[model samples]
Target: MTWTDDDPGQGEPPAILGLAKLRTARAQEIRRAQDTLTTASGDAGVGWQAQSQTAFAAEVQKTAGDVELLAVGMEKQAAVLTQYAGQLSQLKDRQRILEQRRASAKSSLARANAMMPGGLFSEPTPAPFVLAGEEDSTAEAKAEEEARQRAAAESKIAAAQADLRAIESEWDALVADRRRVDQSCSTALEAADILGAVSSFSGSAVSAASPGDLLDRLSVLSAIDLQVLLAAHPELAEKLQAASTQDVATWWNALDAEHQQTFIVGLPNIIGSLNGVSALGRVAANRINAANRLEAIERTLADWKRQAAQPGSFTNATSQISALEDEIKYLRGAVSEPPTVQLYLYDKDADRIIEMIGTPSPETKRVVTYTPGTLANLDGFYSGDTQSIADWLHKRDEDGMVAFVVKDGRYPQNPLTEANDQQYARGIAQNLADFEEVAFTDPLLEGRQSVAIGHSWGVANITVSEALGAHYDKVVSLSGAGAPADWTPSPTTEYRDFSYDDILQFAQDIRVGEHGAVWSGRNPREVGFAHEDYYDAPLTWKSFPGNGLVNPLLAAAGGIESHNLAASTAPGNLTLLNDMRDFINEAGAPR
Candidate 1:
């Protein structure tokens, strides 16, 4: 694009105050559009007689509002440009003055140099800076005489060089204000842009109908129209989250597969996190999201490097750099390694991940998702041995069992401090419930038996999720914790919970004892289960409720060990490990 001195509307804003006159003209043009919208919105406030009168008026008002916002955004952008131009003018003026000071310093430094034996005070341009102590072969004086000759000259040269450095510093600071202005303005303009800068700029408005309403409207709308709406409001599809999973699944499944992939490609981050998307679709979409995250990291890393060019920046930002690098390594490994795993859900905002060990298809007979306990994080999953549990289960799939690892979530990080906290479980239950319903509702796996498996606090997560209406054929808890105060399981769903009767088992008292369950504490043993058993299978059951000798010492180590999983293939008590594997195998497939 080429711009004459005629107008800013012709091209980009130039970096001078005179050019801001052009930007002001552009702002005036935008204000005219805003004035038109303001008038239209006023007219829409009146009564009109027709069935669609309300709808038409609403459209006018919305369109008008959007145009007004666009005008505002453009005006704000122009205002910033003008402000920046003024700042630039002032900085340039100051920079010119600083240059004069620097020249004087350099001339004075040359005079100081002349006081030394070899230097000439009369040089027009200062000689290239040289150290003060260099022996001037022309000096044939005694020690005291030479010291007296050099002392005042050395001080003058030092002062001149120091002044030169300070002037240069001032010049750098003065110019850098331009970047500061640009950054601040860009940030503010971005916020205004969110008021539909790209979409509303043309003053086009779509339906104000909700997500479920859009489902109906979508049927009659063209694909291009859908794109326009989605482009403008990515949340149009995302709002389906509040609708029924079955409804969402049905609506989504009705779209052409190509359309589905296209939507995923267009907004992978938002689509990947939505329920009712097919696991396959979510996996593909979430992978894109992960790549996008890594790309974002790369941009941030580049920005850091640019900043690092300045002294002291590296020291201040080293930790941030390390974090970025680690995330890169983790994300790269996640996208590529452990070929068995597929990215199902990668919600960067929530810091959550759900990885599938094997693809679920129409023929798949069974599916299982494992939710981890406290202190589980992205680093633990991608960098540590967390995938092994799902990998181990997937390995034994002779027929058709797909395994998933809820490798990371917003679970509490500090076990010791959070051992008593049950709010995390309650908080994530509905989301977990929604996740299962949507992720597994596809035709490919509709008939497959499903298992909800969890360990430690994760058990409480699944249990509360079940209470919230997540359907599962079976529930398995490994060293489970308490659900919410009034938790109850569905009578139809079978439940099996295991605990080592260890110190961790006793830790449940903090939650269950401190807070009461409807009848018993959140202890899985107390909660009704069709078939609940301990891994060790002690000689005496005692139903575990009667008065009897309870040995905390015996179960202490094993109990703590049981809270965390040591995959079937990992080194542990052979008998207990073997039993656990057998149990997982049983829980994983159709009975």
Candidate 2:
């Protein structure tokens, strides 16, 4: 039976039973044809005529075999259809039972209304007319009993209505399932017919047909169905794996919007991880995933709140509840008011991409991705640090548009001890490379200058990403902790920043002397990279142009806060910003 939204009867058992009968008849016809072919072969003459007859019989047998296969496929399709129909029938029966129960409830409620002195509309009959000398207490007790009965009747009615609603919802779901199953069966039947026809062909026609066409046909299927098809055909999965990024994007975009949304919802892990899919598409899917995660966290927080009053559990619950709430708050803000091309490469299991800002587009002339280190997260990225850098770059170069990104590379809890670990930088570097590849594919961004800037341990991340094959025109290691001893800069131009008064630098120098290497083991200055000593750079009170005393005091303070102040836009650190601007301009300038 062909199922459609408007045709309830088509998905019923009777229609499916009829389909089964038709399939059985078709199978019988195929058997009859086989018998007829055998009889015709028997009627052929002997000797020279027998040889011709034998060849004819062989061709007939092959055709009969094709028909038999088709019949078998049809029978299987019929069985599946019957099974789905039976499921629908059972659901309908359950719905009928629910309706019956609801009707019974209504009848009971009516009877109670009629007998409880209410007459369906009036108040309780005056407590059954208290007789002369009858105790008033007895009459009051009767009235209370009548009120209780009325309440019980109302409760029964409400419960029945709720049950009916649930049944209706289930019935709707059943109908949807029936429709999907019917579509799948129909597709199988069509395929069987085509295969049967192809098998009947002689020579190389069958062998010449490529499975690519069949795989392409599945592109029109629902995401869930496609997944089922792939699971059944590992070869198809291999084909998909071999597809190019552009090919993947094209295939993904060809699906209807509804199916695309379904894929995003049903298989986010798959869609989000595919490198060939457009970043915009991945972002769309990832945002949904993030929202789902937030919902789950909120649900857990609610559970925790329910158990918060237990003895000795209040403090722990409160702390966990606060953390969950904060996470939800951050997620909501990140997903809200997203850019036109918001890409979410976040992995909830790893809590990656704490924040990624701005959109990558073809029109972008320059892309600058910043990695923050040590306790840096969504909160830190949104707290002016990311925007200040973007603003500085934009102010420096007004002729070109820049896409500024703030990537939180899952920094370790202890920056001092963990900054040297190469493991932490590995994943971030790979992700950076992938992001660059996907983001720069647009023709408009061809040959555009791309830069990776890391602050503190972030520099180590940038260095590792470069070592891992992230191609950028320039790399900025601002106040870097260190990198691997074997690591080499990958960018065409590499710039290193070290503030002399920076306490981290002093610690790093001492650590290098003790360990014979910086945290990463290789200091950028020791290598063939340009260096900027922000500590020695002159400081000026731009806000207070004539305050001589204020400038020196501010400069002294800048030295003490040099580690962070160098990256800051404070008046005392104006020289540091100027130096950064010059470095970027020179590096980004046409060669």
- Tens digit of lDDT per residue, candidate 2, span 196-257? 33222222322343433443554454443443343434454344455565656556656666
Give residue 465's error in model 2 in angstroms: 2.3
lDDT measured at residue 216 in model 2 versus the true structure, 0 to 100 = 51
Model 2, TM vs. native: 0.52
lDDT of 1 by residue, 212-303 (tens): 65555555433333444565566555465566667668877998886686567655665676677788888878777677788989999989
For candidate 1, give the lDDT: 0.63
Error of 1 at 341 (Å): 4.5
- Candidate 2 achieves a global lDDT of 0.60
- Residue 220 in candidate 2 has what lDDT? 51
Residue pair clashes in candidate 1:
502-559
Ten residues in a row with the worst lDDT in model 1?
A: 3-12
After TM-score superposition, the amount by which residue 274's alpha carbon in candidate 2 deviates from its true location, in angstroms, is: 2.5
